[model samples]
Target: MTLLIRFLRLILGTGVFVLVFGGVELTQPETSTRWAVLGGTLGVLLLLHVWSSPRRGTADDPHPARMSDGKPQSGRAKRQGARPSELAAALAACRSAFASVALFSGVLNVLMLAGSLYMLEVYDRVLPSRSVPTLIGLSVLVAILYAGQGVLDFIRGRILVRIGGALDEALGARVYSSVLKLPLKVGRNGDSMQPVRDLDSVRAFLSGTGPTALFDLPWLPLYLAIIFMFHVLLGLTALVGAIVLVLLTVYAERLTRKPVTSGTQAGIVRNGLTTTGNRNAEVIAALGMGGRMAKRWEEANRDYLAEQRSVSDIAGGFGAVSKVLRMLLQSAMLGVGAWLVIEQQATAGIIITASILSGRALAPVDLVIANWKGFLTARQGWQRLTKVLTVVPADAEPMAMPAPSRHIFMQGVSIAAPGTQRLLVQDASFALEAGHAVGIIGQSGSGKSTLVRALVGAWLPAAGRVRLDGADLDQWSPEDRGRFVGYLPQDVELFAGTVAENIARFEPDADPALVIAAAKTAGAHDLIVGFRDGYETQIGELGEAVSAGQRQRIALARALYRDPFLVVLDEPNSNLDAEGEQALFQAIVSVRQRGGIVALVAHRPSALGTVDFILAMNQGRVQAFGLKDEVLAKLFPRPQPAVAAMPRLRLATEEPAPPLGAAAAGE
Candidate 1:
């Protein structure tokens, strides 16, 4: 498509050039200067086209990076070892589209001369000669040029929109992946969604008029040159206006940069508050804290608006000043042209022509000033996206390894919370073989959930290794690891989908039989069947439609789906009642019976009934690990009767002093 657009532009440019060249030759037979000017302009445009053209990748390149949609990397990108950021690579992929837009802009800017030339000919040629046919001819030619200009402009706009779309296609999934993984790397913060919003801002700027002004900026020199051909004074006037506008643009940047940054920070805070408030709506309402939350949000929003208003005022002020200055400059060119004509140094036609040319020259500057905020936003977004992609580099596709069924081992594993150095589990060395079910028991914050998370690769060990069948967890790709490792987090959160779909992990081609089988194994089949749509029942967002126990049971079904080799359940029965607890117990026994390893993190002793082994943790350290009865006895030894007799003897001795009636009389 890019090539086709380029070819069509080339053909149109050639045809227009031939027509204009012939017309100029016929109209001014003695002047070779016009020919030189036309040739130079074409040469400059061709040079820009070549400079903007897309580069192709080659096998011999030292550093290679994937382009949008997995296209070959551009050989021109010579970054060594480190791959180019995803945003950069994606933009490089759209270089052809950009080149095409540039070419179209060149053609359209050249055609912008139609109005000036038509005015010049009407004043200097047709009116003086009273030639009606000549006037008609000039109008026809200008009309054709204007039509081509409009077509090229439309094509340029379309290409820019597609470039934005292509960029989104290239980086959307990667950005979303970063959004998910960034918390694990940098910890969850207010700006978790910033990357995605940044991407949207970039795409929006590309698809808007901001880039059109940018593309037309380079042609300012061309217009100024034409005005110089008319008269240096007129050209100098336009140049001064352009310089002032450029200065205004720079000033706007300096003035708004801090405010834009502040506004973005404020927006992040506001959005975070909104998200938190929405997530805990019930608590907020029940506690009558809605007004307070709203107040906080309002304060954040007010800050954001203040910053935004500051930026807008600066941009609007500069835009208005530039627009007025540009108009005044055009009028100044006319005044200068009229004086030159009066002095018999130039023709009457030069008056109108120079004014139009000068205005055309300054139009881009005016546009850029007006859209300065958008330009800054796009630039900032680009910088942010580059940083994020750098921070969380793309995952390398590791070589496939066979599924593990032997043992899960943690050799001196130390686990820390994401984005923090505080170790939650330290030197926790342990191993569980196939068919072994270990219940991870601990007090609150003893790192039972943290340990199980490491076992399932949700959190990586800061020190030592987590190995599955002798292979480190990092050796397996996430997709492959997920197939063998099943994890139920302490909080059971389900996505919005049908019960069967959730059980099947939303696989596009999930089998109904397998889904039902997994549900039955998790002991959620009967409960699910009781729903209005049975397995087809739609679970609302976060499984809000179901009760807490139901959500937990459904999550258990999801974790137990496909009979994963390593199943890690973190407080899996937290919300389960007696019946749900029984089902969970049976599910653990079922996993063990199937030769699968189970690591269940639970506070309730009843939930550990089916486990063969117990792993006790305390203060981020493994307290004990052995048979369930042995570990339990060690952790909670039975009280001796001799020790219990002391308190009873003291109580009996004190109570023997008085009966109820004697106590009342004494009182």
Candidate 2:
């Protein structure tokens, strides 16, 4: 638009100059003057047509797509917004966009300069020609020069439009890829929606108005130089006009920027509400709290409206200033041109050409100043993005993985946070035969889950090494170790996809029959089939639509889908009702029957009734390890009743009930 508008003005100004000056030749009544007047008028009309022609930019619309439920889909619906690397990636894209525009601008200015020189030659030499052939030839050469300038201008405009889109794609892909690599902890941190909002801001900065503004920065000086070379006075006038306009724009922007800042703050508050709204959407709907949420939304809307008004007010001021400046500059340029003509210092054609070039020179600068807000916005966003690249991941020494096996050993094992002596679990020494089922029982926060995490290599033991089949776990490759062990954390997370997809997460190519079999064994087959699409039905984010028991079943199915050698379930029975708990017990039995090792953390003895061995934890220490009855007796000493005297079982008497809650929240 900028390029086209300036070029049109160049055409109109040139034609007006020739038409007005050619009238002077008619008054002279000389044959030479009459021929010059007719020749110049024809040349000016050709230039006008060439300059005024349309120069359209690339016009592809934005259509961002994202992957969901392991399937590609289109929308702005992104998971866990941009990561730290994503921000840096956006800046890199912006830098590339800027460079491309600079190149285009250079090409444009060179062609424009060539056109100016050609016009200067025609005015000084060709207009004086008496021969018709000479006039015709000169006119043809000028037409070719204008045509070349027209083509260059068209290309420049197209490049700007296309570059923005290319930059957007590059930035989006990098940010999305970075988000995939971001540590789960950081991506899942904050109010659960922080990642989405932050990433969106980064995306807007890199792919929005900001990159376009950056691209214009290089064109400002190039255009300014083109005008300055025409005539020093005209160049100085345009430069001064630019300075004054810029100052006025800045004042206007400052007024607008404050409201935008307030709007951004209000946006943050609205985002917070939206996040909270999503988290409690169910409760809100069920409890009929629509009125309350609506009221909050109304407040946010009101605040946004006020900010909008402030922005509009400032924009109005800028518009008024722009119109006044345009009028003033136009008056000044004509006045100067008329003065120069009267003084016999310059020809009418030179004065006219300078006037046309002046507007073109100042055009890009106006654009740059108008878009200054975008640059600042992108900069702020860029800094935030840079911070992501510097975020500290959890410190862990890289070590070779152990040999692949289900057998796990903990020799003098202890797990503790850094800079603290408070061991969550300590002095835990145990060994399990390949394919053996071991049950862990303890009070709340007695390191039951911690022990499971250490066993699965999520966290390394602070004081001891874990061994797999006599090889140190640290000696094995992470991938190799992972292949041998499957971990199911306490709170199960499911992607918004089919039951089959969730179950086959580790193996996208796994047979659907196998997935169903695994789901059946996990006790989720019946419930999944009840959905409208059965295994193909969509599950909302985190499986919010499903019951906690169903989520656990799906998670179990997922763990089993890969048929890992060792399955570690922490508090598997926490969310399950009686039937679900029984199903879990049966699932454990089935695993053991199949010669697979199963490890579980449970607080209730009844929950571990199907397990072969029990490991009791107390205050970060292993109190006992043996068969269930033997370990239970040691952990909670009591008199044995007649019914509890069986070798495989024991009844409690004169013993307090376990104080710990029945839960084993795992990682």
Candidate 3:
């Protein structure tokens, strides 16, 4: 199959090359050669359509997945072949659409000759014969052809738009998945939204006139070939103009690449700042730091605008030059054609036809120059998206595993912060069976939160394994693992949705009963019911409509939803009052009672009252892990007393002999 495809490609490519070069020969009469060229062009387009069309595998082709070398592929190799990178897969999916677009472009370009041909007929045929009916028939035929051109052009545009939509449909989810995973792999860089914007840019460019300009560019050679049939001098003049415009397009690309790239970077920075500011609007406003923040944003915006202006100036300048040069070259074609006419080398009709053909040949170049900025943006977006998708490949779905109802185990688990080499938790090993709850205690900056993050699969271990029921955590897909693990980070954030949706983790088909159950377990049922809309109350972004403690309670409810097997909460009670703290204690106890394991990181002693065990950590290392009271005893041992030598020690320390005179002098 591979050999057959290559052979066909070679044959079609050779035919196209031959037709293109052979069309340049002007020895044949214009009428015969034009018909031949037109026929050959259509044939070439048909061949191209055949060559570019996607081939599907069939049952009869047992070795359809074989390599180009004709070897049977291994299972792994077959899998890899079947699963291409996200971007490549998306483009491959659009192959049929693109081929259709190409065919439409060819037809449109052919119809573009209607105007030149009409002028030629009016000047050479109709005027010389003085036939009104012939002219009328010619006009009607040209009108029909023009109408067909318009229809094809509209269809091409629609196809391009759908192609953009198709690409987005195929890759949008994968790109969003990459966006979600990027922060975990690279830490929060404040530019997480750039990948999404890049994808939008590519889609927008595809839907716009930029791609139409690109499609029309390939037909420039065909136009020049037609002009060559008019006269040799006219052909050379048009070719020279095409070459000059091509050079200008290249120069424009070179000149604007840097500015476009810089502008994109600056825009990302400015947007990042805006997002950050908006997220922390309350802090900025309360601290009276709005002016400073605005100043910073203004600086970033100014840089972005400057770079954008530079890109615009380059594209605009080159576009103007290309337009003027095309006009000049068209006039030059007419002047040259007139000279040929004066020399009796060509007819007068040839002058107007050649002039029109030359202008048509250069139109794509001018359009490209005009849309150069968008082209650059789309190209750069493609490059960036490729990098991002490559860096974070799609997650492989693992075999289904049973729900974890046993112990959670960590074996020599050393964890480093994402995107950094420094280990935050070193060689941490522990285990907790069902019906067990462990409280992690440590000083500030210790590895408690980091360890909990790893336990809940928010971060992977640098070296070692986190297992549930003897199976590695990675053996389960994210969705499956999430079903077995619940995590509440130190900073609680809720999405913009109804209260019930947030409590249900935004599950489209979530059970209302389970949502209420989880909320009740978190002791937030009454609080929610007190709201005007109760469970259906709308929550603003980041749960800004709710108090901090309320957000924490809702997050806890989310974590508790569906009653995951392993629950890890970091600083869960930091914002909870005494009542909220009591509710947290009850929630932990409930998890234990239900045979679920829990790992709670807390600084407050009250938060640990219900835990069965304690894991003490210090300076990125586990200090102790045992029964709660035993570990606490080791961490804070009772102070020893010096009972026998107390009198002598007191006598040496007491300097009460400074009498009244010394007291008066001091006074």
Of 2 and 3, the candidate ahead on TM-score is: 3
User: Per-candidate RMSD vs. true structure?
Assistant: 5.6, 12.9, 8.0
Please give the RMSD of candidate 2 to the true structure. 12.9
Give the candidates in order of lDDT, highest first.
3, 1, 2
> Which candidate leads the pack in TM-score?
1
TM of each candidate vs. truth: 0.90, 0.66, 0.87
Candidate with better lDDT, 1 vs 2:
1
Which ten contiguous residues of candidate 1 have the minimum total lDDT? 55-64
Q: What is the lDDT of residue 3 in candidate 1?
A: 61
Q: TM-score-based ranking, best first?
A: 1, 3, 2
lDDT per prediction?
A: 0.81, 0.63, 0.82
Off by over 4 Å in 1: 1-72, 77-82, 643-667
Clashes of 1: 0
TM-score of decoy 2? 0.66
Q: Candidate 3: which pairs clash?
A: none
| Per-residue lDDT of model 1, residues 410-526, tens digit only | 899998998899999999988888999998888898988888888888787899999999999999998889998888998888999898889889988898888888888888999
Model 1: how far residue 604 lies from native, Å? 1.4
